[model samples]
Target: MEQPTLSRATNPLIDALVLQHLQKRFPQSAECLQRELASRDAAAAAPPPTNRHALLMLLAPPGDETPLWATAYAEVRDWVDGALDTEGARYKPELSRLLWPLFAYTYLELLRAGAREQAGGFFASFHADHALMRRDELNQLSQVSSAEQVDASEFARRLLTSRYEVRLSAFSRALLLGFVAERRLQLTLRMLNERIKLALPETLAPSDGGGPAAVALEDD
Candidate 1:
């Protein structure tokens, strides 16, 4: 077997590219990125699992970001509800599945930032509302007998893109965990979820979940 050599020669360029990509994908994230960097750096020095999850959770919050998260959550729910396939979504199904816990954490983060009472409960209510709205929309469209029914392509585009946006917040968090925390991707996500429960008790609990367990990364 051939040995793989590592190089820091391109590290600077790669870091720049990562920043550029992040900025482009999330224009609003520029403000919080400094904090994100500090967190990432801190996380880099930490041992496995402790700082791992918080770092991943931190990825979604810089510069008032939310759209990507909204899309991603929608997609995740779709998969959960059997509307999409494990293979049909954007990120790897296993990776995506493991990272699902961040959605609740992101909502909790937003709630805490506002200091509204019953924040966790409110966010949970909103999630339920969003789910109902989505179901209703789908059902109404299915019953449309007129030629004025929305185009399938347009419908798909809307669903996929919105779902993509929702999921992006969580995905970025996972990416941060993967690149900075140095944990294997699946373990990183698992760490993120478990950490969320520890870091924000109002947002998540062990029993609040019925999702997939963390899987081993493919290359391992």
Candidate 2:
């Protein structure tokens, strides 16, 4: 694999984050910095983080600059739920499956935007509200309070690297997609595109799941 390069964008957060993020992977990162600095006194190469969490936090969308996280997140949250409520009604139980991933991703978005309180509070309000089978997933997500915690967690890693599979009838999927299309929630759509996969055949998908295995990603 090619070595990853880090950016020195002059953002103060990015500057400070480089060493901490690098040290997580390369324990000798301090020496690495000193050596590099010794040879090239005019410039410094930020050490990249081992995981995406740090980068996501530092590079979170312009939305993070909003004066208040709670207010801004509430708008996004209400918009997501409102869309679901309007478009999801006819799909019955199958459509409801989308909520967990949506809720989970919302918390992540807040966390990525440096809203730890909102992330924790959102998780707290909605975590235990999930169905019995999804308790494990909710628990896994709840462990994540900050980007550092997310970078260190296996489950959180899976949420990014793996897809959340839902066995949905074709019609239900169309309805779900229609709403997402109309609202154009870019972050939500991105999460769904990258983190979600649908098992189209009704016969192949599991009917009930509460374990990590239940929400496990599938390989194509």
State which candidate has the highest TM-score.
Answer: 2
Worst 10 residues of 2 by lDDT: 1-10
Look at candidate 2 and give me any clashing residue pairs.
133-210
Worst 10 residues of 1 by lDDT: 1-10
For model 2, what is the alpha-carbon lDDT of residue 199? 48
> What does candidate 1's lDDT look like per residue over 40-140, in tens digits?
44534233323434434444334543333344444444434453233322333333433333443344333435533433343444445334324543343
lDDT, candidate 2, 1-220, per-residue tens: 1211221123323433444433443334434443433343244434333445654544344443423433433444454345344333334455556666666666776777677876777777666547465776777787788988877888777676667776655444444443333343445545555667754543423233333323547543
Looking at model 1, residue 218 earns an lDDT score of: 18
Error of 1 at 21 (Å): 10
Separately for all candidates shown, the number of backbone clashes (residues 3 or more apart, or on different chains) is 12, 1
Model 1 misplaced regions, further than 4 Å: 1-62, 66-72, 75-96, 115-122, 125-212, 215-220
